[model samples]
Target: MSRNIYAFLAIILLLLQNCSGQKTDTKFYDKDFKWSIQIPKDFTKVSAKEWAEKQQKGENALEETTGEEVINEAKTIFVFKTDDMNYFEANYQPFDINIDGDYRENNRNVNHALYQTFRDNMPNARIDTLSSTEKIDSLFFYKYETKIYLPNNQILDIIMYSKLFDKKEFTVNIMFTDPKCGKEMIDAWKNSKFEK
Candidate 1:
């Protein structure tokens, strides 16, 4: 009986250790989006609604879209930053606009729609198309490098990488401030895969 108790205690300790272990990496997954990506420990993930509420109260503030846009399929927008500096916002928004025929044809139309949306969203930002279309595995991606001038007269370099799958579109907009962190963020975006 004493030996059994000791074995159980050891197992409990191991479990507790694992539970208390520092998270050096983090992953965010959404079934509706049918996508997943691994991010670093320093980046904090917050939903769009949660972020807006906190911002209204002046705490841990990050803004992606207006709170009005934070509805329905846009609800779970994930904001990531380090030390009060926002690096990017990642989210998947549903695209229910029907395409006529083939998957390839629909994909082309979807890509064009996504690109138009991006431009419409950031009318002032100067955009440079890094790669219009690139195929990886079963996914086609569109990338943009934009220079956005903030109100404070600061020019921010941003990367907008997007992909469409499972009737939804995924976007990762990363601020290219720190080269190392920027590379990691881009790699995370590229490494992201959707299963559906």
Candidate 2:
């Protein structure tokens, strides 16, 4: 249970989640957040069936580790992947305003909890970088970057950004082991536009 199996399960779930025939083509838009991001044309959407199966596996793995089922009520906005194991997924989950009523601080707290879980449970996980702030287009996102060493001697790099929009949490998860794909993803996300 101290192994990085949960991390591997996550990869399977994400790969299955958006392996459908759907493609981003150009820009992905969301009216609730008033946001749009540029994505590569070659990305394919994850199938619902695959997403569900993989998601459950991930949840089961978590339950075994934490001794409780953390309910996943987050609704996926989209999940896209390429043949290179590069993935991008967006989801919305509940965000409770803290007692201090600070939006960004609350966002940062959520990211901290996730990273701490990785450190506490996964033995070989290395937290390359902790919480940082980055402004993409007009949105300010609290970022968390981590590198998890797999049992097969491969590295899994994950970059996650979260923000609160209208009192809800919106997150973008980018997972890639390839350096080239990571650069490409960073460029695409950096150049994304927020539609007025």
- Per-residue CA lDDT of candidate 2, range 1-196, in tens? 1111233346534633334556657778888777788787777777766666676776675665566555666677776777536877777766566532676655554455555556655666555556688998867887777777766676768887777766577777788877777777777778877665
Q: What is the per-residue lDDT of model 1 for residues 8-119, given as tens digits with 9 covering 90 to 100?
A: 1111112112111222367877676567878876665544444444333211111121122212333335666543333656655555446423434444543443334335
Scanning candidate 1 in windows of ten residues, the lowest lDDT window is 1-10
Poorly placed runs, candidate 2 (over 4 Å): 1-9, 12-24, 98-109, 116-127, 151-153
**Candidate 2 to native Cα RMSD, angstroms:** 4.8
Worst 10 residues of 2 by lDDT: 1-10
lDDT of 1 at 29: 78
